[model samples]
Target: MITIILICIGVLFNIFGCVGLIRLPDVYNRLQAATKCVTLGCCSILLGVVFHYGLSDAGFKALFAIPILFFSATVAAHALIRGAYHFGTKLGEKSVKDDYKEVVK
Candidate 1:
């Protein structure tokens, strides 16, 4: 039962992430959506795997992947956003503020 719920949640998160990728306005926003969604969705899936498999090696592997996915996604998103900022990919005109503008200038 718990495994089923986790899998459902993971699937929904992934779907929402995909929607975010399509709906977000700029590269930075898209990266944020993709990173957060994928990491969270994958983490849930991995947790489901751990639940289903118990203390088996595969379960352990899935458990280990959760942290790795979280950290890697965060770092990768930050790096991409930084790169986009450096390259001057203009934010959508609807953007209300530019937090990095002063730093980049």
Candidate 2:
């Protein structure tokens, strides 16, 4: 019941992430959106797994993975974007600002 609901919500988030990845204008925006949404989605699914399986091995693994996924996804996204910026990737035409433009150099 609750597990199913959580799983469904997670699935929706994952779908939204995929959509964002496809529709966003630039690499940075797309990666940020996909990372954030997918991280939350995967964490939610892992939580549902914990609820469904309790303290079993699989549940424990899923529980452990939640934090790893959350941190890694965000950190990886930041690193990738920073690297892209440093490598001279241009911002999208519609981007209103570049917070890193002055600070990064």
Estimate, for each residue in 3-101, the C-alpha lDDT of model 1 and write its tens digit: 999999999999999999999888878887898887898999999999999999999999999888888888888899898989989998788988778
* Local accuracy of candidate 2 as per-residue lDDT tens digits, 1-105: 889999998999999999999999999889977898998998899889999999999999999998889788878988998888899999999999877788877
Local distance difference test, each candidate: 0.90, 0.90
Report the error of model 1 at residue 37, Å. Answer: 1.5
TM values, all candidates = 0.93, 0.91
Poorest 10 consecutive residues by lDDT, candidate 2: 96-105
* Backbone clashes, each candidate: 0, 0
